[model samples]
Each structure stands twice: as structure tokens, then as C-alpha cells.
Target chain A: MYWEKEIETMDREQLERLQAVRLRETLERAKKSVHYGKRFAEMGLDIGGIRTDADVEKLPLTTKDDLRENWPYGFLACSRDELIRMHSSSGTTGRATVIFHTTRDIGAWTNLLARCMYMAGMRRSDVFQNMMTYGLFTGGLGFHYGAEKIGALVIPAGAGNSKRQIQLMRDFETTAIHIIPSYALHLSTVFTEVGVDPRRDTKLRLAFLGAEPHSEKMRRKIEDLYGFRAFNSYGLSEMNGPGMAFECPEQDGMHIWEDNYIVEIIDPMTLKPVPDGEEGELVTTTLLREGMPILRYRTMDLTRIIPGPCPCGRTHRRIERIKGRTDDMMILKGVNIFPIQIEKKLMEIPGVGTNFVIILDRADYNDSMTVKVEVQKEFFGGDLRQLEALRRRIVEELKSDILITPRVDLVEPDSLPQSEGKAKRVIDNRKD
Target chain B: MISYQLSIFAENKPGRLAAVTRVLAKEKINIRATTISTSDTFGVIHLIVDDPARAEDALTKAGMTVSLSRVLAVVIPDQPGGLDRLTQLLLTENVNINNAYGFVLEGHRKAVFVVSVDQIEKAEALLEKNGFQTLDAEALSAIEPFHYMKY
Candidate 1:
């Protein structure tokens, strides 16, 4: 059940000691780079004063805007020649945030991913089909190397091409897959179109889902449709994608591997650590990354440390699945609404398809939200009254959950806008 | 027997109908009659096409939501009260019409009034019993609206 048994079950105090040593080493490496070097010097930070991982809280939180303003090399902790690979966010919203990795850094990331997979029941005998996009985006290569390290036959079946993905699964007898949650839900329709019930026709037994934060209901829906144990993967490119934290077989919450990184949950407003079980912004500091040392990076992702110990015996503390990114929240009429909240409610209503778009508009000094939901083809019937009722029900349910009635438009399946690999769920047309 | 019409879901925006028509025109499916029912932001385009199954398949492949709905295509007189007579009969039979559209095949002689109703079987029986002629899918698709016009 353990990957690196000694490290996996390391005593909490011992782990903190190891983290302190790594934190110092990381700061040392970070000082070598132009970005962190200047900041550390200007702030008069004494790396020697850091005795334990808890000392990370004293350091300032690094934001993505800092990474962006610094651009390509601001966050690099090592020399340019020391870098072996780099992965970046899409940068659609702003300047792309890039994370570099040295060879040792790559090796470290691979080991963590391998540990994550092993904890989720992946083994050497498994044939892993990685469905994430391969280039630039870290989701593909991170898991690709990790699955390979586990001695699994790695099928780097990149994203999309659902038909070919299915054929390859059957042709290669693939037993495991890594995919985004939305794409996984979309692929189920293609499975039916090709007369392939994944549960019966494919050898798939495990799925690792990530890249975007999806609700627990979304995970269970994919699990039921694919007839496999779906594991929730948590990671951002800043924290070495796909391996930051992962769900064990218990499936209660994701165990953030504290061995490689130190984590904190803080209120976004006060910038102070919240209670252990309270939901707050996740601030992470890389203890192991060498190519780039990000110190107390304000992840902007919102989640909480689960209060109790997990059944899975690894002492690494677990975190509840990411609720939503602080960046993804929208304030409509003074009430803050996360797209995930609407999604969580949408998933509960049967006949609502997986894809939806939240459009915000302003007119006459008042803000209005319109949710365009894709109606499942199976539920659409000849009667207009039934469709109208579905529309009203969607609006009513969303109103009760979101505290405001949003105009719900029932659209055709696959009609909502999508960009890159992830769907552009919200279109904020309101001008300030 | 009840005939079928293709009902398509579309956002209320320019070029939506054009896109639908382009798919039908590309597939060589002729439209016999069409009507649009719209709400605030979206609408449904109900079409009596030459072939509904093929139209549905083509439109769905083109990424449009299309459904086949049971409708009665009754031949009525081309006079002013032709539609009123049919609706009155439907009202008398307690058969509510969800959607209805009509087109004249031959002026002053015959016209077709198509209606989508909840109690379809009952509507068809009442219409037939009341000396009204209901067209089947083949006859409905074969209709040439305004073919009698010399213009």
C-alpha cells in the first residue's frame, strides 16, 4: 500500500525536520536565481533562522501576478543550464506562468507522481493510457513519467480523439487512464456512439482525473459511467502538475504529500492561516523543486485541511477536494458565486448534460447572470412543456443555491464554447 | 396514423436559422412547412421536412439539438375559417395543441394544417371521425405548398 514506505510513513516530527532542511536548501537555490535572489536580499530574510517548516508562514506569499510580472525567468532558482524542462499555464487570461524543472527536479516530480499512482492502486502490471495534452501543459508529461517509473506500459494517448482513445484502450488492453474530468464525461457519449460500454468492453480499472477542480458529484458520475474507481488528482503547474496531492483508495479526500512540499490554508482577506478544518485559500511552498523555488506561493485555490486522520495510514495530512479557485469566483449582486457551486447543483439534476456556460451581463446599472445549460439528448422530448419545465426547474434550483435567479437557457448538447482543453465555462461580458 | 416533424433547439441569435437551413439544404431535405416558437433567449424551430429521421440525423451531426415530434397533418379547406374549424374540433375533443402551422397546397380548394398535440391518438381519431382528412408522413412530405400559383 506504500510507495516509499519509510518516507511515506515518516513520523510527523521527522517529516517537519526534513522539510526544514529542504526549505533552507530551496532558499539557498532560490537565492541563486535573479527573481528570488533580489526579493530575499531586499526583505533581509535569514535562511538560517528557518528551523522548521512552520517558519514558512513568516515569509511573504508569492502571487501568480508576481510570476507573470517577472515573466520567463523571475522564479527560477537554478542557473539556466540546470533546467531540463518547462511547463506553463495557458496564459489566456494574462501572461503565462511558467515553471522550470532541473533534471533532479524532474526526477523528484516523477517519484511523487509514482507515489501518488501507487497509493491509488496503480502497479507495474497496469497499462496506463495518459489522455492529457502532451506539450507545455504539465498534466501529460508529469503523469507520463510517473506511470513509466512504476513500470506500467505507458500509452501517451494525448487529449481528444475520443474514438481513437477508445480503440486504443481496447487494442492495447489499457487498464488505467489519466484524463480531465470534463473530457471524461464528454467521452462517455462517444463510448455509447461506438457501441462500447467502458465497463464491459474496456479493461479500464482506474482513472486519475485532474487539471481542473471538479466537484465530488462529477467524480462519482464519471466513476459510475466508466465503472472504475476514479481518483481525484490535485496539482497546478506551479507545484509540479498532477502529483501535488492525490486520493487514496479511501476516496474521502486527497492526501497532499507533505514530504515534497509544505502547505497552509489561509483566509484570502486576512492572509492569515485559517483553522485546520476551515476552508481557505491554499498557500504552498515548494520544499523539493530545484529548477524554480517558489516560496509560500499563494495558490489561489480554495480548500481546507481535513480535520481527522485518513484511513489510509500515510501520515501526510489530507485536504478536501479543491472547492474553487479564488480567481474563479464571481460576485453577482454582492453575493459571491463560484462556478463549481452551480456545477455541483447542476450535477444533481438528472437530464442536465455535463457542459454549461455562465454568462454575466450588465444593463441599466443592474447585473444579470445567464446560465446556458446543455440538455441531454435523451431527456429532450417532443413536448415543449417538458423542456420548459426543465428550464424552470434549473433556474429555481440554481436560484436557491446561488441566492439569485439566473436566466437558464437550455441549449443543445456540445453547443457551449470550449477553448484549449478546458471549457471556457464563464464569459464575463460586464464592463466595469 | 400520426406524422412526425423535426423540432430543433436554437439560441435566439442571428444566423442560427441560417445554419439550420444550410444543414437541411446540404442534406437535400426539403422543408414542407416551418414555424419557430421562441422564449426569451432561445427558440425551437419546428419543421415539416421531406424526411424527419434523415433531417434529425443530419442536423444532430451538425451539432444542433433535433427531436422528432408526433403531429397531425390535416387537409382543410383553403377558406378563412379552415384553421378555425380544425382548432374548434380539437378544442371540442379536449385535445390541446402544443404547436400548429399551416400552408395552402391549392388556393380556395385545399390546405394542410399541421398540429402537435399531447393526446395524439385521440386527436387523430376525432379529426378522422369529424370528416377531416389527415395526411400521413409520405403524403405530408409530398405536399407542394403554393405549387398552384402561376407567379
Candidate 2:
């Protein structure tokens, strides 16, 4: 039964052949995008000359700085044929990154997203209310298209309108949800405020969350909200948004759609590939995308890709949940701080919510970072002393790790805006 | 009736007022009259100036956060008992008078009392209810043109 699927059970040789065939077409298509056209020329390689995966990696890795240098449309590798649509990535720290998707690319994404839903045992009879904000952005459209393609009735109940989202769930008998992990807790709050028991009133069985790195603690919270199993979906808008990979019912790790995108882990400093179980930066290549095919695009997200058998029986490569971003490190007093580390420390605090902000500033020629947090009410009911204790603990942990002291502020739950799509983490207060 | 107002932040140092004036002098901004309510560390300086906005901006850029507020200018009886009546009414209203000062209309013999209050609208309302008079922005500007002139 495990070896039933031909593509899933394909030998390494067959998989290599599949990747090479797709690479050839993607390269030919890449030449049309303005960004890649000049890049391929400068690289001194023709689309037809490239033969294998090594040939693809030998070209060069495209960084965010390179994308910034080209700006807006510098790296479009496709035109009319592969250029079906374009959208922007959330740019909280700097300029927004844009993503282009061909019609075929869109179909492949929906197919993968459908496979994700299937792995979780979601059926066409299930109703899903996607809570992503619709715009010239991939997050909302990615889930919306995928849900519809899977033949599930989807409500484009964009984020923040919790009142209607809840009503829609009750009225439509919504069985599944596709939204940011944070918003799911907000739903529980609305349910309680409206005097409805989530486990009692509605039929929410599964939740698919993406667009931000959430803690395992948050996954448990969402699961407890409606007695539904919550799964994490991972993707960047540059790589066709939210459908890139998702967790199966087993919840071991996210399954990377290797048939379409080649995922690799490389040491960010040395730029050399790391073996399985070693944490490194996630670099992705579009094995099948026609419009604007990315060749070793550095995602800046750090994770370990574990290649092996999944209980779900999908041959897709599994990536251990993200460690954090290397480029987007929060520097405090010459020390590198990451939001995921903050999340880990925060999750241990009983009352703390998953959201936190690293307030950045310049003081006396050194960076001063303050961690401001919000506590959940069930864990902390407006107790100032308890908040103070948590703050002291956080300061101690941050100090021990960064070797610099920081001020920690505890705020009320839901103090930070429940992000509609992208979560804001770093706050630069030097100017404001 | 006349009123003059100036906004200053609540930061304290011995030469803080001097710093404010020095910036005013460099910018050619004139000060007509001034009073500062100071605690151990914070000061709220309510002064009459040629330009309030520009002066506020200069002070903000210079690292002093300031907020502009309106004060009431009332015509007192020009007698000692006249001042007592207003302050007593204010005490009854529970409004702290942060600062107070005035100038005499030399020709008219009218003594104008310029009073700053924590609650401007309520203090003005109580004064108006008690049959006192006040000045609008234009009239206040005429007395303190240095304030209405922005930059």
C-alpha cells in the first residue's frame, strides 16, 4: 500500500530525470523575465546548455540584495506565456518583494495545496472559510485558489472581521479553516465573547496556518480552541505563497513539494550544503515554474531538510520546522537576536502569548533592544506582580544568551494587532 | 480680558529655560512674558511668544517634547479681593492652576489675569458662568502676535 503511487515511489534516477526535464523548460522560460534574462547572460550559460541539478546550482544564488538592486521588475524571467499574474510579499522591515506566478504555476500550487488538505483528510463535503486578506498579495489568493480547486466551498472571509467569520462558520457549517495561526485564537475569543462554545456550537475539524513562524505552543492552543487538529503550512510569497508545503495529519514536519520545487539547506556563511539534521538556510529552486523561475533563491529562513519516508506516504522532501531567519536578525548591543528565540523563551512563560516585539534603538553607539510581550488572560488575569515576574525572567534569559540586559514590558492580551496576514516582529524606534 | 499661552515639556534642569530662550533668540522668536511651574524634575513653562508652532518645533527637534494648550484671560476688578474670588472659585472647581501672570492695560487701567489650568474648557466654562470674559484666538494674537506668527 505504501508503494502504490508511482511518482512517490520513483527511484532516485527517475526523480533526477524529472527534475532535469522540468529545469530545461523553466530555464527557457527564465530567459524571458527581465531579471533573469540579464542574469543568465551575465552567467555565460544558455538555457539549453544546463543539464543537471549541479548545473542549476553552479549558476548563482539570488539574494534579497540582488532583488533590491533590480527592484520591482528587474528579475522577471517570464512574459506572456508564464506571466499570468504577480503579487507582493509582506515587507515589514524594508521594501516589498514581488512574486510572479504563471497559470501553470498556479495550478501546480493548487494541486499541492489539495494534496496537503487530502493528507489531513479534508474532503469536498467540508466547508472552509479562508481568513487571509485579499490584495495584490499572494497569501490570500494562494489559499483561496487552492481551496476552490480542491472543490471545497470557501468563504473569502478576509482577516479581522471576526464577527462575520464566526457567523459564517455557524451558518455554513464550516468544517475546516485556512488562516494565520494567530487569528485562530482570536476566533476563540470571539466565540467566548458571543457566549458560544467552540467545541459545542461549530464543526471546525482542521486548521491550516501559514504566513508566519508560530510556536508549537500556539499549535496546541489552536487545537484546543475547537478541538480541531491545527497544521502548519510554510511558504514565502516569492515561492508561490502559502501552498509550497504543509503538515500532514501525523504533524511530523512540512512536506516540501519536491516534484515542483527543489529544496536545499546550505550554511549561510560558507554557502555549502549541510547534511540531514544540520540546520542551514533554506534555498529553493522552481523545478517546474515557467514564469520567473528562481534558480537557488535564498529564502533566508533556516531549517533542516530530512529526506526519508513519512507515515503519510508522500515522497515529498520533509523540512524540519523553521529555526529562524539569518538576515533578519535583531541586533542588540552587537548581539544577534532572532524572533524565534524570543518565541521559544516566551512560550515557556505561562501567561505569555506567542506574539512579541523586539524594540530596536541606538543608545550611546550601541543597540538597545526591549522585548514587549502580551499575556493570555487564562494564564494571567490582570496580575501586575505576575507580569513583573515574567518580565524579569525574560530579561534574565535574554541577558544570559545575548550577554546584554534588556527591559521587558508585559501588555494585555490581544494588545498587539492580530495580524491579518503578516506578523510584525521588529520595531525600529530610532526614528519614531 | 487677555490671555497668553506657551507650551513646554516636563523635563527639569537648572538651565532648561535658558536653553529654550537661546533657541528663541537664535530664531529671532520673541518672548513677551513667561511663567514656569516646576517640580523637582519637570517643568511646564507657560509663556507668551511671537510664534508658538515654530518655537514648539524647534524645541521638539532640540529634544524637548512640548504640548500647546489654551489659557483663560479674564478681566479682574484690579483689586486684591478680585483675584481671591477667581482662585477660590477655581479651588472649588478642583482645578489646579499650573501658573498665572498678567499685564496692565496702561491706558484703560484694566488688569488682565492670564491663568493656566489643567482643564481649560471647564475652567473657562466656570469663569464664563461666573460672568467673566475671555479672548478669542485673534484677540489673544493681538496681545501675543509673537505666538500667532508661525516661524
Candidate 3:
């Protein structure tokens, strides 16, 4: 029943043995590249001496800065002629880190995606609609090839155009779809406006939501609204898009494909491995990548590994849903908070809309946070007292959630900026 | 009783009022009587329009929060004590006026006073019993202020 039954269900001992072999090959491949080769020679590291997964600690950690320093082809282990595709980050902060793939690498990625989708109960009979952005972003094509590999009829619908997305679901009788969780929440309103209840009208039964960090409450919200089992998928462009980990049918935690990558949870500050079940930055080593192998690439995503075995029988260890990216965490008034925590609280409130903007500024020699939320249109019809109550409720809820009382401003529905990809929830204007 | 006033929730910012007016203007909805009530950061614009439902729809579709509230329109003498007499009469009956605005129909003779009270039926009954004439939607829409002016 498994896509790669033997590889996926191999016992822990056997899987580690396989990882050791692949890890050696991966190191060898990295040594052929300019970036890792110089570093390996300069450090006098021996690729052959590294026998087990634990020995991988001997290698220095690779950061995003390392990837950018090398840039376009610095990490290429294969010749340019063998490279078939490349995907780069949006590079909003700086230079984009581009990951290249060979024909064999593409096949492996496709198989992992198919395995992820299959573990989540997708089958050949299902019609899959990919709702993420295509090109550059790995989410679109990553799931695309996987669904197609599983023999599902793939509809690459891309993103935005909510009305047409609904129309496509109706026309094609789409049974499965992949989308960002926030966009899915935003699309539910459009479905209501178009008068087509997604639960009643569409054939959608499964949704693979990822590419942004979200909370469990948000997942339940999508499931309740869309009438589907919303599975959380996790991956980064550095880790081959979205096939890195996925929730099995049990839906407790995402099963990280150990056969494909070496997963390590390390204290982001010390760069040392934390005990299992402890939250820390995820460092991954591409075990099977050919075009470029990133060894011990610090993902900067904070999550914990579930220590117990999954009932799904996949020997691949499971990682908890990403709590928050280290870079996305905000500190206000000596309190550390993530935007997802605020999102979880806001989604719990009935009248608060899905889109919200958190603005952090300096006021009166202290940090001030203002959460600008969009009030649902239905709540606007209520009297002034009701509106006042809603504002007070939001302020109280947020104060209890983030431990800091924020100024709450309720604006009109759809007033906040709607993100087509990667919702920008925070704006820090405090002059550092 | 049929007359409706579009009460809009607006923030106290430049161009907010202009935005609402622009939507009505685009819809070709004529504003009959307008009053703005403001607090520190927010305000409400209560407007008597030629078409209350259509104006509400236009403003709402333009992303402004609007509600159609039924308000009482009473006829009062356009004199120095016109509003005072109305207020004194309401005070005698213990009717509380939440909001009220007036405009003269004919100089020094008659005027129209629009009032929003906590209890509409009681205030209407009290006003009618006192012989103070109240206008319905039909009469209010037909009011032509400054019609006697040459310009």
C-alpha cells in the first residue's frame, strides 16, 4: 500500500544504515562542488571516515548566507547540462538562494511528493487541483508532479481568482486540492458570496495546506468551513519544496521522509542537537539530491520531533507542525510572540476576519503593538455597543494570548491587504 | 414612520466623509438633510436621501458601514423657540431624544425637525397626541427648503 513500501516502512536500524550509505555519497557529491570542496579541503575533512548519521556532526553547519554567498551555481555538484530545473526564493530580503535539480533529482522529489499525498489518503481516482503559485516557488510544481505521479488528474489552477477557483472545483469535480491555509480561509468568504457552499457544492474531500506556518485552530477552521480533512504539509525551498514532511491519515504529526533527508533538531543558539521532543531549529541534509546537496543546512524553522513511533508504520520520524520561523518571531514590550499565536486567537473569535495586520511601533518610550483586524460584514450591522464589545473582546483575548494588551482597530471587511502568497502579517516600524 | 435615515460608521480621518459623499454622488443619490455626530476617533454621518435603500446599498457596496434607521420627522414653527418647544414637549412626556437635527422650510414660519429617540412608537404617539405634525417618508421627501428664495 506504500509508495516505496520497503523504504518507507524500514525499521529504524535499517533506515539509519541506509542513511549512512546515502550520507557518504551525499558528502562525496558535495566535495565535487566548489563551495563544499574548498571548505572540506581547508578543514581536512575525510568523507570516507564519516560512517554513521551522528558522525555528520563533524561537518560545519551551512547557513542561508552560505547559499547566497555561493549564489546561482556555487553549490552545483552536477554539470550545468545535467540540471533540468531550478527554483529560487523570492529574495525579498536579499539575494535569492536557488536550488537546482537534475532529472534524477526531479524523479526523487516527485516520488516523495507522491508518497506524501498517498500517505494522506490521496489515490489515482482523485482529481487534484494545485492552488499555489507556479514557477520559482516550489509549492506549485512540487505537489503537481507528486499528484500526477500518483496518477491523479492534476489541475494546476495556480493562485488567486477565488470565483474561478470555485468554478473549477465545480466544473472538474475536483476531489483534492493544495493551498496555503490563509488563502483557503479567505476563499471561504468568496464561496459564500458566490452562494456555493464548498462543503455542499464541491467534491473536495482533502486539502494539503502549507508554505506558511499556521496553528491547529486554523486547520480546524478550514476543515469546518470547507468540509474536508485539511492536512498540514511542511517543507522549504531549501528542502525541496513541500515533500519533506506530511501528515499521515492519523493526522497527529507530519512524517519527515528520513530516507530522503537526514533530519536534525538543534538548539539554534548553540548549533547542538536537542533531546528528541524538544523544539529547536531544523537542520536537514539532502541525502539523495544530485544537482546540489545541502549538508546540514540550517532551515531556521522551529519545531520539535515526536519521539514515539507513528501508528502509520512509516519508520520515518514525525516532526511537530512548524511553530514559527526564527526570523518571524517578534519581541514587543519584553514579550516574545509569533504572529501565528495572534492568528490562532483571532481565528477563535467569531466576528474577526481572516486577514489581520500587526503593526509594532514605538510610543511614549515603550513598544506599542496595534492589531488592525477586519470585522466581518455581518458584525457591522450591530449597534455601537456590540461593536464596542467586539473590540474589547479582541483586546482581552489578545492580552491573554500574547501577554501584552494591543490596541485593536476593527476595519471594514477585506480592508487589510490580501496576500496571494505568503501572507505578510507583521509590520515593525520601531526605529532600532 | 416610513422615512429612513442612512447612518454610516466612519472614522475621523480626512477624505472619509468625501469618500462616502462621492459614492452617493456617483449613484446620483440626492442628499436631502445631513448631520455628522463625532467622538474622538470615529463619527456617524446621518443622511436623509432621496432614496434611502439605494443610498445605503451604494455606500455599503463601496465598503462603508451603513444602516437604514427609521427616524421621526416633525414639523415645527421656524421661530427662536421652535426647537425649545419641541424639546419641552418631549421633556413633559419623558421622551429621550438620542439625536435631532432641523432645517427651515420657510423663513420664520415653519421648519422640519428630524429626531431619533429611544422609543419611536411612544414618542410618535406622544407627539401626535400633542397636535405636533409628524411627516412620513412621502412628506419628508417632498420638502423643498429655500424654495421661496429668488436665487
Candidate 4:
């Protein structure tokens, strides 16, 4: 039942031995790049010292800033002709981090993705509908080839066109779909609007949701709405997106492919490893990548390594669902709040729609937060008093969760901005 | 009495109301009485149309959220205490009016007060028992406030 059965169920001792060999090869490849070669020469570091998996700490961490400073090609370990594909990060914050992949790198990524899909119960008979942006974003192509590898009828339905998406599902009897969590929730309304209940009308049976940090409550919400099993898939573009880790039928935590990536959880402030099962920033090292093998790459995603073995019988280690990115955290009134916390609180309350905006502004020398949420269309006919009561309930729930009371504004449906990719939940206008 | 009102959820934008009207006009649906209640960012347009079912289908098919709710249309004298009299009677019966709007049917003589109540059947029975005239859907749709206007 396992993809790459020998490697997936490899015993701990053999897994570590394999990791050590791959770690040595990865380090050797990393040093071939101009960036790592300069660092090694300046620090007088020896690549031969990385003899075991535990010795990976001897290497300094690679940050996104390093990739940005080097720009287009400083991390290239091969000639331009050897590189087959390049994917750049969505530069929402600043400069985008671009990574090159050789043809072999593409093959390995596709195989890893196929393994993720098979572990989640997807088979060759399943019709996979991919609903992410295709070009630069890794989510689209990453899952595309993987589904194709599994011999599924792949529907390359890139994001947006909600009506058409539903039509496609109905026309092709789409059995499985890969989509972002928020977009899945947003599309649920479109299904209702088009008079097609996804649970009743389509032949969909499985969903792979990822590319955004979401709560368990959100996962259950999607599953309940779609009447199917929604498995959480975790990945970032730096590590070759959407297939780094996947949850099995157990549906507990994502079984990270340890054979491909040596995972580390570290305290962001101390830059030291945290205890097992403790929450910290995720650090990953690509063990088999050829074009650009990033070592000790700080992913900035906050998650803990799940301590025990999964029920799925895979020897690969698992990580808890990502809580929030370190950079995505917001401090208001001296209280730290993650947008996912607010989302969890909102999704639990009935009548509150899927779209919301958290606006942080300054008023009278004090920080103020306003959560503008769209009231579901069914709730719009409610009287003013009922709407006011809903607003107060939302405020109370948010206050209890974030330790600060926020003004709640109930807007009409489709009033807030909709994103086809990652949903932007925060708007911080407070000037530093 | 059964009176139908089309309730539409609208965002607060410059041409949002115009868009609703444009749809109704295109469908040849005549609006008899209307009320707009707005919050900071959104509002609801309650319209008493000539054909409630047709208006609802047209608006919904045009991608607007529309609901047809039963309301009460009470006839009141076009005088100083007409609204107060109707409201005071309903207050005595403990019936609350969620929304109400009125338009003069004849100069200095009569007007129609359209009200949405929590308990539609009970409010209608209470108004009729108190000797107040409640117009049905046919009577409501037949109202033409501009009949006395001279060209």
C-alpha cells in the first residue's frame, strides 16, 4: 500500500544511515554553489565534517534573505544549460526567492508528490482536478505531474472561474480535487449559488488542501461541507512546494518525507534545536536536490515534529499542522495574535461567512483592530438587533481568543476581496 | 392579508441601488413602495413590487441575493396622528415592527404604511380586530401615488 515501500518503511537505523549518506552528498553539492562556496572558504569550514545526520548542525542556516541578496543565480550549482525549470516565490513582502531545478530534480519532485497522493488514498482511477495558479507558483505544476504520474485523469483547472469549476466537476465526474483551504471554503458558496450541492451533485470523494496555514476546525468544516475526506498537504516553494509532507488516512499529522528532507525544529530566537514534540520554526535540508541543494534552510513556518509514530505504518516522521509563520504574527496592544487563531474562532461561529479582513490601525495613540466579516447571504435578512447580536458575539469570541476587543463590522456577501491563491487576511496600516 | 416584499442585500456603493433598479426596470417589474436601511458598508433594499415572484427570480438569476417575505400593508389617513395611531395599537398588542415605510396615495386624504413584523399573521389579525384596514397583495400592487399628478 506504500509508495516506495522499502524506503518508506525503512527501520530507524537504516533511515539514519541513509540520511547521513544523502546529507554528505547534499553538502557536497551545496558547496559547489558560489554562495555556499564563499561562506565555506571565509569560515574555513570543511564539508567533510558533515559525517552523520546529527552533525548537520555544524552548517549555518540559510535564510530567505541570503537567497534574495544573491538574486537570480548565486545559488546555482550547475551551468545554465543543466537547469530545466525555475520557480520564484510570490514576492508579497519584498524580493522573491527563485530556485532552479534540473531535469533530475523535477523527476524526484514528481515522484515525491506521487508518493504524497498515494499515501492519501488517491489512485489511478481518481480524476484529479488541480485548482491552483499554474505559472510561477509551485502549487500548480507540483501536484499536476504527481497526479499524472499516478495515471489519473488530470484536469488542469487553474484557480478562479468558480461557476466553470463547478461545471467542470459536474461534466467530468471529478473524483478528487487539490485546492487551497480558504479557496475551498469560498467556492462552497458558489456551489450553492449555482444550485449544485457538492455533496450531492458531484462525484468528488477526496480533497488535498494546502499552501496556507489553517486550523483543524477549518479542515473539518471543509470536509463536512463537501462530504468527503479533506487531507491537509503541507509544502513551501523553497522545498519544492505542495509535496513535502502529507497526511495519511489516519488524518492526524502530516508524514514528512524524511528520506528526501532532514527536518529540524529550532527555537527562532535562540537558533538552537528545541525538544522533540515542542513547537518551533521548521528547518529543512533537501537531501536529493541537484540544481540547488539548500542545507539547513529556515522555512519560517512554526510547527512541531509529532512525537510518536503514525498509525499508517510509514517510517517517515510527521509534523503538526503549521500554526503560523513567524513573520505572519501581529502584535497589537502588546498581545501577540496569529491570523489563524482569529480564523479558527470565526469559523466556529455560525452565520459568519468564509471571507474576513483583519485591519490594524492607530486611533488616539492606541492600536485598534477591526475585523470586517461578511455575513452569509442567508443571514442578511435578519433584523438589525439580530445582526448586532452577531456582531457582539464575534467581538466577544475574538476578545477571548486574542485578549483584545476588536470592532466587528458585518458586511454583505462578496464585499471583501477574494484571492485565487493565498488569501491575504491581514491589513496592518499602523505606521512604525 | 398576504403582502410580498422583495428584500435585497446590497453593498454600500455609489451605483449599487441603481444596479438593482436597472435589473427591475429591465424585467418590467414595477416597484410600488421601497425602503432602504443601510449600515456603514452594506444595506438592504426592501421593495414592494407588482410581481413578487417574477422580481425575486429575476434578481436572483441576475446574481443578487433576494428574499420574498410576507409583510402587512395598512391603510392610514394622511393626517398628523395616522402613523402614531397604527404604531400605538400594535404596541398595545405587543407586536413589534421590524421595518416600516409609507407613501401618500392621495393628497391630504390617504396613505399606505408597509410594515414587516416578527409575527405576520398575528399582527395582521390584531390590526383587523382593532378596526384597522390591512391591504392584501392585490390592493397593494394596485396603488398609484402619482395618479393625481397633473402634467
Name the best candidate (by DockQ). 1
TM-score of 1: 0.60
Residue runs of model 3 more than 4 Å from their true location after superposition: A91-93, A329-432, B1-151
Pick the winner on DockQ between candidates 3 and 4: 4
Per-model chain B TM-scores are: 0.92, 0.67, 0.89, 0.91
Candidate 3 C-alpha lDDT tens digits along A323-422:
7676676755323466767888898998887689999886433468999887776666524555667888999988876767899887666767884577
DockQ of predictions, in order shown: 0.36, 0.03, 0.14, 0.19
Q: Worst ten-residue run, lDDT, model 1 chain B?
A: B142-151
Predicted candidate 2 versus true structure: per-residue lDDT over A28-146, tens digit per residue: 77777677788778978767778886676576788867777877667676555547787776522234566677787788877767767767767778898888777765667777877
After best superposition, candidate 2 residue A405: deviation in angstroms?
28
What value does the lDDT take at residue A215 in candidate 2? 69
TM-score top scorer: 2
Q: Which regions in candidate 2 have their CA more than 4 angstroms from the true location?
A: A1-4, A46-49, A91-94, A329-432, B1-151
User: How many pairs of residues collide in model 2?
Assistant: 10
- Kindly report which residue stretches of model 4 are placed more than 4 angstroms away from their true locations once superposed: A91-94, A329-432, B1-151
